[model samples]
Target: MYQKNPNLYLKNQVMSASPNKLIEMLLEGGIKNIRLGILALEKEQLVKASEYLLKAQDIVSELRYSINTEIDSEIPQQLIQLYDFMYSQLVIGNIDQDIKVLQEVQKLLTELLETWKEISVAG
Candidate 1:
């Protein structure tokens, strides 16, 4: 969808993203991909779904480690809670519901990115 409907990814909005903000955006993008993968699985496209989900897992894994090293994160403490919830739901969610969650996650990351941009601009 991203390649086909670049608009769905909001390319212009993402292009304006700063470097640090970009990382969070990538994490959100990963979540979105994971949900899409689940949708693919529901549609019985196992190979495609696995591919997307693997990509998503790889992205989150990278970001999770990067956060540990790069930032003094009180956020991780919170993210652990969210991660647990997301994991639990991952096991339980149908494809449609997972996609909904992914969309929400994307919106949240976009907000975080914008907040960081605001701080940088202010400073």
Candidate 2:
């Protein structure tokens, strides 16, 4: 029986992903982290919550940086603003242990992920 290394498998997948697919993966990762953070917060595990929320924030930051403003200035600018808002909410939710804020961010990420999936499939 042969088992592939999980890390190597992930690296290969990432290497082969199209830009849109990469963005979709990032969105899914961010959403997963946010959900974990919320669960950790509910469990009164502040450290775990902080860690998960920070990962989600980092993903949002990556998405913001990946946007090409020169290609379409207005839309990219708007997306950057939305990402900034999500990052800010993640920080505040982690600090205050605010489940409501975390839920709001989760909703936004879900909507974005849905739209990204649609675009990826259509294009």
Candidate 3:
């Protein structure tokens, strides 16, 4: 019984993914961790909630960092601002034990994910 390591599998997937696919993966991860954070907050698991929120913040940060600043489009600036807002909300949600803030970020990331899917499909 040779079972693959889940972490290794995920690493391989990321290493092989295209730039657009990587964005999709990060957005999905952000949503997943925020959902986990929300559940942890609901359960009163403050430390665990903090951990998940931190992971979500890291994912959002990575997504923001991946954007190209040299592009003359307003989209990159908007994305940077959005990621900045999401990161701050994550911090506030963790500190205040606020599930609503986490849910807001989750919804935003989910919408971004859907937009990415449409772009990939149309491209």
Candidate 4:
């Protein structure tokens, strides 16, 4: 349902939206920032990468509880697993590992976003 118009769901749930919706938006934004951070890091902008990555992690952490409730159960579980992998990569400071985890996170979120879009359009 959400494969066609992700903007609908994303726009409908910005931070100004209800708490539950806000969490969902934060999750999407955080994932986006993570990707941005990786790109920044690739460009050797360590400081920028650190700033963005930290913010993304912070947002995700803040919404941990709410996300568990508002996100699709399967999605959250996959995110949890990915988060663990990401955190490990962060600790290990492995560029390859980070890239792999980032790819997985992006893929997962992209799928969910698409699903939301499909649902919005169908409804």
The global C-alpha lDDT for each of the candidates, from Candidate 1 onward, is 0.61, 0.91, 0.90, 0.62
Per-residue lDDT of 1-123 in model 4, one digit per residue for the tens? 455888776665463586545545666777787788779878888777777777766665564444464655698776666556545444333244365565565666566557655755676
lDDT value, candidate 4, whole model: 0.62
Candidate 2 worst ten-residue window by lDDT? 1-10
lDDT of 2 by residue, 1-123 (tens): 115578787788899999988998999999999999999988999899999999999999999999998884588889999999999998898889999999999999999999998887888
For model 3, the stretches where C-alpha displacement exceeds 4 angstroms are 1-4
**Per-residue lDDT of candidate 1, residues 1-123 (tens digit):** 688887967887678877676675775677577667767877988678767766665665555555543457777766555545544444333344455655455455456556656776786
Clashes of 4: 10
**Would you give me the overall lDDT of model 2?**
0.91
Q: What RMSD does each model have against the real structure?
A: 6.4, 1.7, 1.3, 8.0
Q: Kindly report which residue stretches of model 1 are placed more than 4 angstroms away from their true locations once superposed.
A: 1-17, 68-73, 76-123
Q: What is the lDDT of residue 9 in candidate 2?
A: 79
Reference-based lDDT, residue 84, model 2: 96
Which candidate achieves the best lDDT against the true structure?
2
Better of 1 and 2 by lDDT: 2
